[model samples]
Target: MSEKKPSLLEGFKAFLMRGNVIDLAVAVVIGAAFTNIVNAVVKGVINPLVGAFGTKNLDSYSSCLKAPCEVGPDGEMQGIQIMWGSVLGATLQFLITAAVVYFLMVLPMARYLARREAQRKAKEGVQETLEVTELEVLKEIRDALVAQRAGGNAGPEGSPAPGDRG
Candidate 1:
């Protein structure tokens, strides 16, 4: 009999029920909240520190690439301006976030997984050795029984050999 195929809704539900998808959703939410904190730190602490040498607002720092850049009374730019300072600020935030996540989360998880794998392998090795030892003992017992039967010069139950009795 041909098996019935699952419907599209069933397949979608199964995908959503997986642990990885739920974990990813949670991570995305947390990451969004973390971005806000990183943005605040950049705007508050880092900006003031960098502001010591120049303007405090990173977005305000720019260069006239076209040499005719001008801001009108309505705060409209007339030429191309390269905003390198904003890019630097964004880069710093990303680096800080990445470093923290790697050191605090990724590295420890990796080490734990490696340790667990090693323990599993060691346990399997012990079980395999025990099996091999048991097999060797069984073979030894079988060989002894075969040799005793072949000799047959003595009777059963510790009695003297038939030819030894005078």
Candidate 2:
């Protein structure tokens, strides 16, 4: 009997139910929530430290493309202004977030995974192969052949050697 094919809806449902998709969805939610914490750290800690260089808030830093960057009493600018403070703030926030994620989460998780895998391999008694040179392999093969020709009973520890008839 021919097997029935899954409908598009069923296929889509299966894809949505995959572990990675669910994990990605959860990660997106958690990342959105974690943004507040990162932002708080940047604003409360990093911003002050950076502000010691010039201003408390990066938004105050600007460059004027045209002459007379002065603003009127109504906050109307007289020339073109490059708000580099906003760029600095955004860059600082991104750097802080990346550093925190790398140091606190990514680094630790990678270390843990590496340690776990090593431990698992050790538990499974998986021995790492020695780095044998080509010459060493050739020597081993030569010794086995010599022992076989000499009939010195080197038959792979159990079976008959190469020249043996049955």
Candidate 3:
């Protein structure tokens, strides 16, 4: 008996041809490109504007220890050098990225989805209205059939005509 091995090319083709896989690939590429653009904007425009406010590029906003800790005979400092400025800069970057992504991408996406949902509901409303109208007509027909079967004039017994119903 001979065993057949699956072709790698066939598997690759199938993976690439899947709908969700293709969408994910496209999203990843677009996300990478968007990240570069956001980084450039942060580095170029926002950083400079922040620097004008004396923040100094968001990376130099920390204070260093004035008195250096004692060093060993080998000349290495016993105390650690705190790089809090880098952490501040990273936090600022994260905030800016979050704000931009929310305002530029997420907010608009939510608005667009809401509008699309509203339009879908509007369309469904029309269908529902038609269904309700048909139901009302059927109810009227059923009432008439019941009245006819009872051998009455489809009105309350001993009731006057429409003009005299008051």
Candidate 4:
């Protein structure tokens, strides 16, 4: 008998039904929306500030050859145009994103988790100390029981019986 292949719909349904897959899909959508905001911030605020430092636009800072460079048919210089400015802009955006995520999300989350851990540790410490104290008390009780048993078996003047002497 030939094996039946799973349909695309079934595969898609399984994918969507997975917990992590659905979460990832939601995260991707949110990330895309957040990217737009970050892009606007970079283009509007950061670019102007960088431009004031003589870099004009983020797309214009590149190494270009002067005279003796090969000329195209349109009389334009034909040299290796390294678009380093775009790279710089992308790098800046990444830095900004990292900074924002760190300060806004990661830092607070870390602090909250730390506080929770500390509280848990404090609770555990108290529990462990209580257990230790209880054990100590139990040991004292056991020692008392053993002492009582020994006392009951001993002779009147704290001497052993003839048969107890070893």
What C-alpha lDDT, on a 0 to 100 scale, does residue 160 get in candidate 4?
A: 67
User: CA shift at 147, candidate 4, in angstroms?
Assistant: 2.1
lDDT of 4 by residue, 1-166 (tens): 9999999999999988989998899999988998998999999999999999886589888765444446699988687666789999999999999898899999999999999999999999999999999999999999986776676767668876545774
Expressed as tens digits, the lDDT of each residue in 26-144 for candidate 2 is 99999999999988988899889889998989888999999789987898998888999989999989988899899999999999999999998886663433334556788999997
For each candidate, give its TM-score against the true structure. 0.73, 0.65, 0.66, 0.72
Per-residue CA lDDT of candidate 3, range 55-102, in tens? 656776655464465566998865555667678666767787789889
Error of 2 at 4 (Å): 6.6
Q: Candidate 1: worst 10 consecutive residues by lDDT?
A: 157-166
Error of 3 at 28 (Å): 2.7
User: Best by lDDT, which number?
Assistant: 1
Alpha-carbon RMSD, each predicted model: 4.6, 8.3, 7.6, 5.9
Top-TM-score structure, candidate number: 1
Candidate 1: count of backbone clashes, pairs at least 3 residues apart or interchain: 0
Tell me the deviation in Å of residue 166 in model 4: 27
How accurate locally is residue 37 in candidate 3, as Cα lDDT from 0 to 100?
78
Q: In candidate 2, residue 19 scores what lDDT?
A: 100
lDDT score for residue 37 of model 2: 94
Which stretches of model 3 miss by more than 4 angstroms?
1-5, 53-55, 65-79, 149-166
Give the worst 10-residue stretch by lDDT in candidate 4.
62-71
Return whichever of 1 and 3 wins on TM-score: 1
